[model samples]
Target: MTHRGAEPPDGTGFLAVRCDVTDSRQVDRAFEEAEAAHGPVTVLIANAGVTHDRLLPLMREEDFTSVVDTNLTGAFRVARRAARGMLRVGHGRIVLVSSTAALHGAAGQSNYAAAKAGLVGLARSLTREFGPRDITCNVVAPGLTDTDMARALTPEQQSELLRRTPAGRAAHPDEVAEAVAFLAGAGYVRGAVIPVDGGAGLGH
Candidate 1:
């Protein structure tokens, strides 16, 4: 589900419904609408995320909770909802879009890091729970992607990250999407954490 109305440029076989992942009702309704339009959902990508950057010492309780609620708990809501249809069909793919911060913690991002880290646990646990049913769960951890979120980072932050990255540049959004697409089709690659971070998360 997206937060804004979206339509395919080609305008065929696509419906974009605005739904908030943090709300269970919205999550259910979104799935209902999708299923109504195109039948039961066989693939789910839990990609909703938000950041509230602050050092642990300076972070407010809400900062931590809100990030976790949206990034981690929101994933849970959608994954759980999608599992129902997958269970009936006995086949599915769930890909969670995590971050390199989840593997190598970023300074001033304790909340975002923790929330993303939780996704690994959730995906692995779901892998075990759903494997017997022919369902797979995986995570894609991307770093410094060329997206609005990455652009929002200060130039200094971007420079520091690029300096650390062996490839010396940010990833294209399509690079991350490629990994997600691979996971969706690879039935044997369950509970894996694929990093599309241009080696920025190497050795972590």
Candidate 2:
């Protein structure tokens, strides 16, 4: 697949790089390389993630730390770098990939939920600090998505999730990606968290 830049279907101005979000060396190198290829990172999508699920009392230290390192600290690394560029240029987009668990609280996902929830605050804080510079920071909270990650679940679990979801099915990853793309494109929008959860957790 493509990794460096977007073609006609995607756009003229884009550079896509695969990076380990948890690693500072990789993040620095990737951003440096991407900036060289496509100018500064005007739009940042911190979507790198992983799951280490287990009940809190039964969970190991590594499990909790790993998820926190990747989901929370990882996004922070990328966003911090991107924000620096955005603040300097006086314009940018920072759309974080959060989760419905961030709000609803997953039974065996304390680490994941806490990490994702932190992103909302992080995005909002940036919005206040950088809004005058035309930088918009937002979050997209996706529900059960029909990705390899969800497909790995038992068939019964998948079916039950579909039953609970108002749309009666899992969402395509592109569906969530669309929300992120929207926030990226809309210059005036900032500090917003859009839930792409098919009405699964329309909280109070």
Q: What is the C-alpha RMSD of each candidate to the true structure, in Å?
A: 1.7, 3.5
lDDT by residue for model 2 (1-204), tens: 113222324564545565777788878888888888877789888887778879989999999889989888988999898877777788899888899889888778898999999999998998888847788889999989988778876797678767878998899999998898898899887898899989997553
TM-score of each: 0.95, 0.89
Error of 2 at 155 (Å): 3.1
Model 1: per-residue Cα lDDT over 27-57, one tens digit each = 9999999999878889999998889998889
Could you tell me how far off, in angstroms, the CA of residue 197 lies in candidate 1 after the best superposition?
A: 0.4
lDDT of each: 0.91, 0.83
Task: List candidate 2 stretches off by more than 4 Å.
Answer: 1-16
